[model samples]
Target: MFSDSEIPFDVIQAYLETHYHVHGRAPTTLQVGEANALLAALHETAGVACSAFLTACNPFSQQLEPPRNLELQEALAESLQQRGLRFIGGIGQHPANGWPGEESFLVLGLALDDAKALGTQLGQNAIVWSGADATPKLLLLR
Candidate 1:
């Protein structure tokens, strides 16, 4: 479906089918194009109209060692903290298995432009973003 990306079609398919889990007091699972009521409530509670699901692992779809991926994720978290952004740890995984779950963050109130910039900065091909609609969309950056 995401044929425009240089990323392989199968990889894009995996992204579309993967579950993006947000960890918090009330953990939530996000699926692309599916409206999440809990996330909607979260937006309301946080007084934020949008959020972005981002990861620094496997940059440009090049698989990295688990330790290195974790280190990159830590840096991403630190960067968000330094920006004074509210975020929750998360992971993106395909339910059918095979692909390793990627460590991610659900950054609250991050704008679309900022999300794209961050994804590009992290050498990511894409990011999952949602607005007040609470429906996650796969946004290609490359």
Candidate 2:
């Protein structure tokens, strides 16, 4: 599994190539991981479906105290410990706790149940995408 402290420049590419065994082309970002929305949802609920938490930060979006809190972290940690899901490379500067940005991506771990919960919580703020399971699509700040 990939460690949060040691993500390579071509980390995502390497994961795809190694796991999928089909390295057709490399991507600028990693799109083969879990979604940010789902991670947020699980954090909000504090449920058992919580997968690993892959911090995604950029120059734009930053972390807040309310929306994401210590309780959420505990829940995520507990849930992930139970599940077999592994935390991989993130989409921002800090792989552990990245800052947020507009269009910035956050790579999080989530099970199917967690994704469903996220869909319900998102309601209007987020969208349901089928192409990739959990890779966040991040954008840069000025």
Candidate 3:
């Protein structure tokens, strides 16, 4: 779990604004925190050496079909690997909100420049952030 002191409210707010600009709605604080925590955990688990984290959220609404979700997951993994990024652990149902229609968070670790390049390539399919900056950089591949 990442502390609020590490992420801060302002950073989360900025992320929310970026998310809204891409998704057209605001995500709950829990959703934002879940992504941040997952990213931080990846960094910590890697001994604080990861330069950036790339995360993709597969929302239930977009994955009504069972195979669609799995396909998305596989595609995300393959995409990261194709770019030479490392796939880290992912969290299902961020925040454990106990909702039937929660989202899945897929995490990837890569260099900051690589992550940024991938983000540009993805173009709204996922969210990209640098651990060093603590600010969301891009939303890709939607």
Candidate 4:
């Protein structure tokens, strides 16, 4: 079961099932609703109580050309950089589904309100947010 949202049920399922892989030192994968020890450690190491995994590609889940998606992702990265936010590259991959892996970012220390605002501003349907508990939750925007 999933929360009520404009997003399709199947799409929500895909989101929950997707592996959100974070890169750089201490690479680890995050799963929805599951407490990740690595993520908890990362939060401690990064000195952040919260983080968000988000992408600017496939606005509202509408598939876009690879080049366009790449452009959007790069823009998102630039936006974060401009804000001076610490972030790590990530990818949301759902192997069970045929959808391609989406490039995302694990933005450290982004508050819930700010994360939601950024996701909305980027036209994303949802984002994965984790608190101090380090359990990722799918937050629908539409």
What is candidate 1's lDDT per residue for 1-142, written digit by digit as tens? 5666788888788888999999998799999999999999988999999999999999998999999999999999999999999998999989995889999999999999999999999999889999989999999886
Clashes of each: 0, 13, 11, 0
What is the alpha-carbon RMSD of candidate 1 to the true structure?
A: 0.9
Q: Give the 10-residue window scoring lowest on summed lDDT in candidate 2.
A: 18-27
C-alpha lDDT score of every prediction, in listed order: 0.93, 0.32, 0.42, 0.93
lDDT of 4 by residue, 34-129 (tens): 999999998999899999999998999999999999999999999999999999998999977889999999999999999999999999988999
Per-model TM-score on C-alpha atoms = 0.97, 0.28, 0.43, 0.96
Q: Which has the better TM-score: candidate 2, or candidate 3?
A: 3
lDDT tens readout by residue for model 2, 80-134: 4566444333222223322332122121345444544433332212212222233
Off by over 4 Å in 1: none
| Model 3 whole-model lDDT (C-alpha atoms) | 0.42
Residue pairs in candidate 1 whose N, alpha carbon or C atoms collide under 3 angstroms? none
| lDDT by residue for model 3 (20-139), tens | 111112222223323454445445665554443333333412334656656765676787667665454333232222323322333335666666565545333344454533333533
Question: What is the alpha-carbon RMSD of candidate 2 to the true structure?
Answer: 14.1
Clashes of 4: 0
| C-alpha RMSD for every candidate | 0.9, 14.1, 10.5, 1.1
- Candidate 2 vs candidate 4: the lDDT winner is 4
